[model samples]
Target chain A: MSDVTALHPGDTGLSVATGRTEALTGIAAGLAWLLAAVAAAAFDDLGDWLETQNYAIGVGVFGLSFIVLGLTGRWFPRGAAWVTRAGPWLIALGLVLTLWQLAAAKLGWLPQPFFPPPQGILEVYTFEYEELASHFLASFRLLAVGFVIGTIAGFLVGVSIGWSHKAGYWVHPVLRFIGPLPATSLLPIVFFAFPSSWSASIFLIALAAGFPVAVLTWSGVANVNTAYYDVARTLGVKPLGLIFKVAIPAALPNVFIGLFMALGAAFSALMVAELVGVKAGIGFYIQWSQGWASYANVYAALILLALLCSGSITLLFRIRDRLLSWQKGLVKW
Target chain B: MVAVELRPEQPAASAGASLDIENVSHAFDLDGSVLRVLDSVSLNVEPGEFVALLGPSGCGKSTLLRLIAGLEPPRAGQLRENGQPITGPHPSRVVVFQDPTLFPWRTVWNNVALGPEAQGSLKQQRERVDATIDLVGLSQFAKAYPHQLSGGMAQRVALARALVNDPEILILDEPLGKLDSLTRLTMQSEIVSLWRSKGFTSILVTHDVEEALFLATRVVIFSERPARIKADFRVDLPYPRHRGDPRLAELRRESLALLGLAASW
Candidate 1:
């Protein structure tokens, strides 16, 4: 890690010569964004469409910032290098947006209602942001609560089943039976059984997250090197110490894998639970927007959901890397 | 000023404890059938004695070490340490297995501190742990993780880990079996010096006849499966015994002959 950080600029992918090319790409990305802005503003709608809410201006500013970054890259070398790495993708996004403007709102090649232009999507974020933000918050809250409860419960269940033969005999069969079934399949029963849709949604998310965690935790505990237990025992470690210190630490790598799986499962469960009955969440928002034929709002909510999930997974990976830094060449991230 | 101390004063060797293994027979349930591993194996080790058990690959030497360490109860007989029956694992009786088995997640210092940490005496034994690390010549690598250390260094850390407990009886199950020849020779001497300084009752299981002859004051040879002691002889040598000693060479040949590997060599 230190070696990479200490590398000279000449040895890096973004050498002085490449740095110049990166600046040019940044400028090119900015120009493409400017073109997208012009395309959105210059063209007249084929039919009556909702107000774009100064979406063109927003696009213009985004383009301007890119142009500025490209021009002033030398002042912030590191930040500019990062921007340079992302330059091609930025240009591609601009080209895609410009094409969307031509196809949907301007030329009517694609129906306006079903396939709203990038500006239309931007308008949802700009104008109906309050509603979207509220739904996002609601979704975030539900997912957070459900995932936390599920992970904690799963960890306990897994540890218990792993450590004791009696617990394993009882819970292992139940887990094997239920663990494979998708939490979404249990929606009808869960909704019927729980008092409120909110509680039901939480339960569903928890169920989705919990199963993987439980199974993986159990695997980790059960598969711990018997030598570790022997060492601890000879050292006068009590039963509880054996579980917490020896078993748990050794099982952490496996536990992280389970946590990652649980995160994915929780995301799936959260969406299904929200889509089925939750009044205010991104999933419900998407459903409601689809009902109103507001595809732009749907697209915006989907983007937010993708960001939330990916960001969460990234955060989990970061935590795992830090915790398991001691591990070498055994498992790759 | 009055000061209260919670535990007994730390002893270097903790006054080596005598071990008495009396007609101990052990077996394993292999798919519902009892596969006997030991047959009434009886041996008495005096305090501070370095006794090496030499045998073939599957001669149950390790199983006997485990029995002595109280990792498992023998099927038929009792093993006593300092006149007390070893029902289960105790800090005073520790085994260093063939594998270093240091926790990958822990630094060398933390690994060495495991005994005290497990016994809930880490706060008091911290200095002893450091001293043991230094004793094994690993003071510089105390903060290094197990994965970073070479095989020999890892074994040294394992030694420090067991020694930090101030164990009276140190059981070694082919502890140096996996090391390279050069490192193995260095470690053999280190073990001898440590045994001398600590005065712990050491029982080592080794496959190498020369190793047994060099390090142990007494070498006990065992027969094949369900191991029974075939021969026991004393190596009457002083500290820092030379590898080229004619007496050691004579004993190695005898040990090899007993294990039925003499004809090949």
Candidate 2:
């Protein structure tokens, strides 16, 4: 801890003090695990209690981890940073899980079939991993296809409408009328229009994703600074060159805004589409599990959905960062 | 130091085209009202000569440059390039706007390469593109994007972009207007050096009287509102004229008085 404190100047005492606090937090986390283990072993459960082996293993592993991290964290700066940052959150998570186990499983404060112990949800992952993986893959495939088609079609049409006066005149009013109609609200019509449930789902997702791209692309193209066009024109850029070179590049920041909106809308549409008629996806898994009162499976599937949505959004943001790096400080992330 | 060399073999004789603006007038339709910007503006810029149009703000000096660039058709009369009537924007004439107007998406090299690229001569003139960028002292920043540049650096890229085309006429619409005082002064000399080297017929529109007298071989002043060529003065000083030259000081005073400002110099 003293060596770590020497790494940064002007704050030696404060740094040493913070390092001590970090070690203390780690010990507290270990203690919380011990307390949970004691409760699990001694307390009488209001409901039928399963064997406490899983809880015992978890407590032991966590307790060992905290003890190791506390003693040796300052030796490695990278490890120290992680421990300092995540130590409190880990402690809070452990406390929350312990309390949940006591209330939901031991005391039966929350009714069964609706609320399950944390171990029960973990058990679903352990037992039904294959089925969950398949469902996730299916949903991912549908999202990829629909998202690609929608974004491409939307971009082309938006660029056309924005670039050409004739196209704008013909399409702008029609877009204005239909673009505002929510894609989910069109489900009844979509069902009648499409022959298969899969096609209907894809269509719904595509429509959901396309509107924002089109509208934002239109506005982006329309609002490009006239000075850019003037400069390009004097440089001998033809009409096609003007559209492709000046208008498109200038409008890219707004196009990314459209893509972000499309991602959100696509996710919402994906979930709803899967719930309505899709045979196998995470959303369908949730609905099917809910019908049989398998709350553990439902919670497990919900967790997977959360991870998948956030993971995909993160991927999109990474791509945006790479392409639009010039706009770094101008936009507030 | 790698000596920056512009392509000397690129037909220097036809590189500068004499501009003849004969009784030209232009107006803009501002919300169903005709705002007369230029009224019978007539001037001649000889090939390889540096001419400056000096005027007050909103006096349509820039509008006249745009006309010469063929960006807009005059409301009346004709603008000619080497005896040919100007009908539309051509590759032989390029305008550098006050805003730099560097496409934010492109790097310094790509922005400067846009002119040759548009002309479909990028394949043949690739070396010229590299040379022009080097000439502007931005070879190190070839791959740097426009947003990464300072105001002065971006404007240098803009100038490089115009020069790469090897335009017969280079029209500058107060291209250094947005720079800080120090950057502006530096750029003023850079522009003069570039003009001296290239020897393209140049027309600069500026509100700064000192800038006009410093850069232009001939200075034409415009009146407010319906801008007409009020007066034209020839600067016969030798190349590399001193800033504190008594002749320049005399002309600055007279030009300021003509523009309805008391000379502070």
Candidate 3:
């Protein structure tokens, strides 16, 4: 038993003694951030910029918090464990921030307008937050509507094809022909055909998300265990029961896979649609900023989009984990 | 007032239903070629009889059970249950297959509750499901998932799932085929007791000779693919028969000989 525990560290509550290195990393990260703040305060920017006081204060506060966390690790063991896990990432981020500040802001080595200092991006957020937020909300509304409709329609289509030979025969050929075409390629035609740009964007997003969902859900339903159907059949279950009770539940793991793919594709389609078809979104904000040649706004909007993508995907996985808890460890994310 | 007529009680009909498999021949089309499995097999089982069909692996015994369960119709034959032509799957004819085949998503209670739920009778028969789960000695595990179960435990849950329906004809397709030896021994006795108590007509297909001798009232042996009936005989032993009984040993030896493994015995 001891040998087994030795082989699998942390299995028997014998987690490796850690946090010392993490504390060291935390202190180093704090020093790096403080140095970056000093550079921001001490140097003059090569590009047109706002006063560096707020940015320097923000960096200094972040540095102080890290230093406190590093010094007071004994009080919160859980927090310490988290810090231990994130030590390398924290260190890397701090060093990168310091280097970026020195390279772009202090020294005039990098090109102006293209590679603005960290403060330039931060200033965009500080001043133009309201506009960015409105754009985010618009994107959110469009994405939510399109994604829900696409998921439902795709799931229904998949089920119909998977469960019925007639449906499969009729729809499978069409799906094969059109499913692989990127929704963005039809942008000009779609925008011209629809009554409104918003509707066209919605349609494009749905098209992008729906194809993978339908194909994957079809395969999921088609590949159910025959024994499950037999069991249900012997229990006097009807055809509908076989599809809903037996097939759907059995195919859920695969359905989740389809949903993940759909979400990723939906995001791509959303950005493209917003870029060309729609007037207001994060993608639109980036395009608008690019037109004005304000690289700082573009950078800010891109970071926001990144955060949104990460957050939405994380939420999707959480829901999947809860619903398919029985299938934990069976399929890797 | 309308006149109401009363009929006399017929206990036999309620106890178990008789099964008749007449001239059953089955084949599967594999790559445009017909692979014949069962050839002109006929067997009539009396109500409440425990009949065991023993044959070589892949000799179409399971296919025969499937036909009896009305999962699939025989290529050329008629199956009648209680003198009515079998059409399709019915709740009264439940099967405990070799693998547990329990839905991983459902708990033990829900898995056993499948029959009543599918039949749209779960609301009233909820207690019956619990009682059935308790019968299989898994009351504590009623809420446990299939993946959480050991092989024997999962098999017991499968048995409970079949029993919860109160099937008149319990078709067991090698139900105990995959259990460990010790669990298999325990389950063999459990099956016998359940049959005696419930008085359900049982048709078990297994490869174990000793298991057949121990649990079944009559043992039917069949030949290889395109299977033909080799022998049919009654065990004639009373319930709770000893494993070391001289008569059982004699019967086992005879059964092995019929299967053409006499030299080993």
Candidate 4:
């Protein structure tokens, strides 16, 4: 077994192969820079381009970083380990970017406005960071509030429906009928029912998040091994105690499954909800930029949305790791 | 090593409870058809007696153990402990099933601590949890999750969980059935010693006649499904009985014959 300290790259032993990989990564990065420099110097017909000079500076910085790394990387084993791990991916990314630049800016094979240069996307971050940040924060707030409320409500309803026969008899049919329906299909009703667009959007997001959590939680609670209840009962655990202590803990892996499903649904709902008259958020920004025919801004917003959704999911996974550590090897993720 | 005594602080009078099963009959509904498992079975287990229910596979020995544990009310008869009728499961009667069934989410310590926690006595009986874990020789693994432990180790944790309750009647439903032969032998002695020290009324159900003869004061053999007692043999051996004892060997042969395995033996 590896020692706990091996979690730190500095504490890990390095091989000659790893050092060689790092050197190769540096060479690939340098080659990418050379290609980008030649393309920029040679081509001048890439008209009305935004942040055209910034690409050269970006390539130059990348090349210098790799060259320095190749020379001094062996001295810093931790940094060298990171370089080795990312080496192949870095090489692929460099090659892809070189090809992309050659096709778009140099050859002009792709149509204008449809396929913006990579620098056009980067320029959005530099020029419109404040607007993007505000939209991001707005979207984040709606997601957090909707997710928290939805999950709490789903969990309680699920436990109730699962644990009590009467509750299941009444609630199960209702859930079955409503849970499968798309939350977006109710957008017209949601808009009219709520006092403001924000509340309507929040409602849509909540509805989207709630169904998966409720369904999965219900299944989880229902399918727990009866032996656990038998054990708890023999130990003199009462109904509430049995549910909280035995059933909930046993159902955690399934609950996490529900949470992941909820996240996907919530992200979808947030985008759709924002497009329906919400002035702030990534979804609104996408629609707003598309109206002005700024496809570059649309692409930029899309990239931000991708990062945001993935980041939230990753955060949820980290929480699951902390809470359900006992299920570590049992689950592949 | 001396058998680790359990609940030494509790009064001896409240330690073991006598079990009386009167004309018990049990059946399950299989696709709307009645499948009788145990029929007209009656037995009286004395307080602190170590009794083994020896039967063939599918003979409902485990069903009987579960009845005694009060997991279910018998279909026809009354099961009583210390003159009180058994209506439902209680902490006083605990069963160790063939599968350890330790909550996979809980660590060894939390699993052992469950009884006290359930009974609302965890604050006062906290040390009993630690002591039981130590007695089971799993002190070092108290914080280890159930998945981290081997089959034998998980079974040991299950035993400790029952022992922590200091149950008056400890029901064993082929608790060591899944273990390897070597671990099975070791657990047999461990169980015997625990029973001797704790003085709980132990009802161990096993198909192994030798195992029954080794640890039990009396071996009750059951016939095929719709099970009824075929024979009850009193083992008059002393504590710390050896597997190689000639008397045990003799009784083993007799018990095997009673179990309808004479031709095979």
Which candidate number would show the highest TM-score if scored against the true structure? Answer: 3
Error of 1 at A243 (Å): 0.5
Model 4 stretches astray by more than 4 angstroms: A1-14, A41-45, A328-333, B1-14
Q: Write the per-residue lDDT of candidate 3 for residues B11-129, one digit (tens) a residue.
A: 23345789998999999999999999999999999998999999999999999999999999889989999999999999899999999999998999999999989878898888888
lDDT of 1 by residue, B184-251 (tens): 99999888877776678999999888888889989888988899999988999986799999878887
Give the distance in Å from residue A106's predicted Cα in candidate 1 to where it truly belongs.
Answer: 2.1
TM-score of chain B of each: 0.93, 0.94, 0.94, 0.95
Per-candidate Cα lDDT values, in order, are 0.87, 0.85, 0.88, 0.85
Please tell me how candidate 1 rates in CAPRI terms.
high
Q: For model 3, which pairs clash?
A: none
List the candidate numbers ranked by DockQ, top first: 1, 2, 3, 4
lDDT of 2 by residue, A1-333 (tens): 777667855586677877887678777777777666666666765655354657657776777677667767668656556666777887787787788878877888888968987767867887799999999999998888889888887888789998899999998898889887888898988988999988998998998889899988988999999999999999999999999998887888888889889989999999999988789899999999999999989999999999888888788878878887766464434
Predictions ranked by lDDT, top down? 3, 1, 4, 2
Estimate the TM-score for candidate 1. 0.92
Candidate 1 lDDT for residue A271: 88
Native-structure RMSD, model 3 = 4.5
lDDT score, candidate 3, position A15: 35
Clashing pairs in 4: none
DockQ of every model listed? 0.81, 0.76, 0.74, 0.73
Model 4 chain B poorest ten-residue lDDT run: B1-10
